[model samples]
Target chain A: MSTSTSTSLTAPTASRVAGTAVLLGLTLAPFLLGPYAVATLSRILVFALLALSVNLLTGLTGLPTLGQSAYFGVGAYTAAVVAKNLTDIGPLQLLIAAGVSALVAVPTGWLAVRARGVVFLMLTLAIGEIVYSAAVNWKPVTGGTDGISGVPPVVPLPGTPALELDGLVYFYVLAVFLLLLGAVTRLGSTPFVLALRGIRDNEPRMKAIGYPTRRYALTVYCGAAALAGAAGSLWVSVQRFVSPGDAGFEIAALALLAVVIGGTGSMWGACAAAALIWLTRDYLGNLEAVAGRGPLLLGLLFVIAVYTLPRGLAGVRLPHQPSRKRTA
Target chain B: MAGWLDGNLVSVVDGIAFGLLLFTIAVGLSLVFGMMDVLNLAHGTLYLAGAYTAYALSDGTVPGLLLALAAGALVGALGGAALTLLTQPLARRGHLDQAVLTLGITFIVADLLAAAFGGEVLPTDPPASLRGTVDLLGHTYPVYRLVFIAVAAALALLVHLVFERSSLGALVRATVADRDMVRAQGVDIRKVLYGVFAFGAALAAVGGVLGAPILGPGPGVDESVLVLSLVVVVVGGLGSVRGALAGALLIGQVQTLGVALLPQYAPFLLFGTMLLVLVVRPHGLVPSAVRT
Candidate 1:
């Protein structure tokens, strides 16, 4: 999955410095941008997390899925339920949401992971649809198509004051986003991830090496579901409303599209692509002339991205990563 | 049990008709996927297009219905050809890329269709001669549905014979088994690929035309039909005619009866049935002998 084509002999120190600069810029972006842009950035961060979740299974484990949004919706609904009925503590809500989503993923993911390729894809798609249908039909529990609203403002911690302003909420989202981003980065370098990469590249070979590939896939599936659930919790926090649409196929498709456009295994690229896609949908679609044409534009973007960015945005060579030989 | 059967008799008949429609659509999908290893997510779009064609052309007459069917098949074939051209380049890239490309096509076509037909469900009427209800065992049933069932069953038999019993079927199966070997034997594999894709897509479109009176054409119809056909393909087994038939009929019953019996959980029944089937037989109810 980590098809790093660059074999450059550049100074590592320079790349480290550039990474620090980029992080610094992101940390200061909310303050520098307008309130509208800051809100959009927060949305981008939530979707970026979802895209990262998709990347874990799709990019890392080679299990293409269309069902992450089910977990996302589950997480969002759980958070909304907690906020309305139990507590407004953001951290607690996020934790419970992620935990529940992971739990739900177990049975579904087990069924899904048993198959490979298109069969797996079909199972996940069915799973997503079922979840969506449940959300719509289970009116007493899920509030039907209307969904749950009137979610209170999120408190970052147990004792901290609630985040009332958009700017403050953006900071709260960023904090959790960075913490999870760090966890995922650490995960990328783990032996488990290495095994997943092995499975992705050649499952039969990995099996011959005595690797329990299905177990790895299931574990990653649950982990990715947890990540998506956390993102869903944040989405509820940001929107203060959870609807069936939150868990619909469009959300799943867009998140996966973000992963594909960003480059499957590249985490940073996913975030960037998520931001670009969000902007295109949120900002460009609202333009006077193009109003209500968001889907059409998104469809065009998908076609163009697949044809032009076959290797994805992250696959582009950076200053330090000079290309040697390209893998066919 | 007799009382229950009497109560649910119409639903059972409806289920068979619905299943036959699904078979018409899904059989093509099973064949194309088995042979080409291409997962055309846009298969439902062809169905939508055919439904729209019926909506536009049918004037409640037998001749008009025939015209709609012909037009629907033609449109489906053209669409299949177009998709083949779009997907051929990605043959080496694997199913994920193919899924993405076809999904994109689906989105674009669905949008265009929405624009042309509006976003409402457009229901077509059966021909005047077929609009009346007829006596079934003890109750009356729609003549159109009964006719549709007969037509669809004939179609199923024709497809089964063509794919399972004919020399062309042998050639197609041979191509699927080993394209290189078939090419070495002086058969044009590309033509076969294109033909299979076109025929499969055309069949789906024809089903759509016939099914429009029952399911109707709406904004999200393509998505729903696509999911159902995917379910049919999975439960019936991937690439075989018998599998599609078995899967479609089973699902059709589940769908119609599940709704009648437990309206609240009908949606779950579709996926639940799929889950059970996969758990029991992962390859499907009737898996194709040749594995991809």
Candidate 2:
């Protein structure tokens, strides 16, 4: 609360510097680290993508949604279904997953865009649960909770070698992550995204000024869903399996929490927070001594973040941002 | 003719009973959100605490349940007061801060609970006095459910009378309508906020304790309760008691009837009903006039 004001006004340069440094460092991490570390980094990247997708809605558009799992599931299923039957072209799978997710978001976002604020949050949570149940129940296609396992490793390019279960797939995943992260960053900087920020700040004024607020909102929502779908596909590629739990409420909730903790409008902050959450949940959570207390630790981190670093990991503080303003 | 009439009667009674249970849990959410404009995501945690209390206190005896009720209410009130006090500093910061802050609290409490309770569903049984079943139209129904209905209905009546009839209720409503005006009238709005929050939390815990036999306590009961309460609050329209009752009954029947009739699609049916309701009445079935 204390630091929110000045950071918002001065965050552009600071965030850019931090973003580039983190991206470069992450891209170089796998090469320097061992196989186990590479695998962990791959998971972190997937989570980063998921958290960034959440930021697209919550931080950029002020939607505060808890439904990224819907898109994430779509991506995972797309990759799994394609890997099971069609080609294991990772790029193609990503595209199909994104497309399918965006398609589903059309009507879902239409219904969701009707409400704003807490109601919007509730609707998204319901939608996520419904989609998750469908995946759990729709047996033939979704594999009915068993999930589509035995997904083949993505076939490498014609000249290159295939990425078998070895550490080779890590590089491929890294490339895909970099490309998607770049695109998301570009998307966030676009005028269309600027319009979304405007909607987040003041919808009525935007509409009064003749901006087609609903259309813009729906578009952004679908786009973010597509990003989440891409992340899911990437998840499948790395894990080679998809489960109902992959699209469960915890993922959606964590992604939202990451965005909130990472400074809402800061993409780099989201990715950083995602990594933090992933490390906490996956690495620290699995420690033998701590046992099953990962959630407790993460919860403590959240409380600390709220109290100490209101701007989240990227630290994009707002300058005299008015409190008690109308929010959804 | 007798069989047809009997079946319909059974469904109606069952629906009302389920609705009453929902009302007991959801009214707390409605009052807290409506009156204080505080979106307490941890509302479900209080219910979870209450359910756990019931689990801890019950020895399959009536006196045990009475003790659980007292403990649940006390813990809930304390929890609510703590939440209000902790959040007062950021109350002026807006809903985003409040949301994040409460979410943090929810996560912390959920983890602590999971640790304490071993991450497994804990079954809780009603007292011996409320156990067993009674015959209804050639079908047997749990007697505890019937008791739940009676007790919940009475609680509802008490709540309605307190809010709609009592002068204290008038003051609370006055604060909700215009905080500055109530303060101008020499009423301490802060005290009212704390009291309402604590009281609402106590009510949620009480519902959790009473309904534990049916809903049960588990690792993720907090999330489920939170989601259900959200649905109830939304469908009932943010802060109105009548709205909360109507929404809870509608959802309660939807849950039981949908699961009974269409087991495969029960979850979807619940969501579908919610989607339909939202589409038809975006503000909810009963919107609060003062709050939004």
DockQ score of each predicted structure, in the order shown: 0.41, 0.59
List candidate 1 segments past 4 Å from native.
A1-25, A32-34, A318-328, B288-292
Pairs clashing in candidate 1?
A: none
Q: Would you estimate the TM-scores of all the predictions?
A: 0.93, 0.93
List, residue by residue over A44-132, the lDDT tens digit for candidate 1: 89999999999898878878788999999999999999999999999999999999999999999998999887667768877888899
- Give the least accurate 10-residue stretch of model 1 chain B, judged by summed lDDT: B283-292
Please provide TM-scores computed only on chain A for all of the candidate models, following their numbering.
0.92, 0.91
* Candidate 1 structure, TM-score to reference: 0.93
- Each model's interface RMSD (Å)? 4.0, 1.7
The C-alpha stretches of model 2 lying farther than 4 A from their native spots are A1-20, A156-159, A316-327, B1-5, B8-12, B287-292
In terms of lDDT, the poorest run of 10 residues in model 2 chain B is B283-292
- lDDT, candidate 2, A40-89, per-residue tens: 88888899899988888888888988888999998899888987898788
Each model's lDDT: 0.88, 0.84
Clashing pairs in 2: A4-A317, A4-A318, A5-A318, A5-A319, A5-A320, A7-A317, A8-A317, A117-A328
Error of 2 at A56 (Å): 1.5
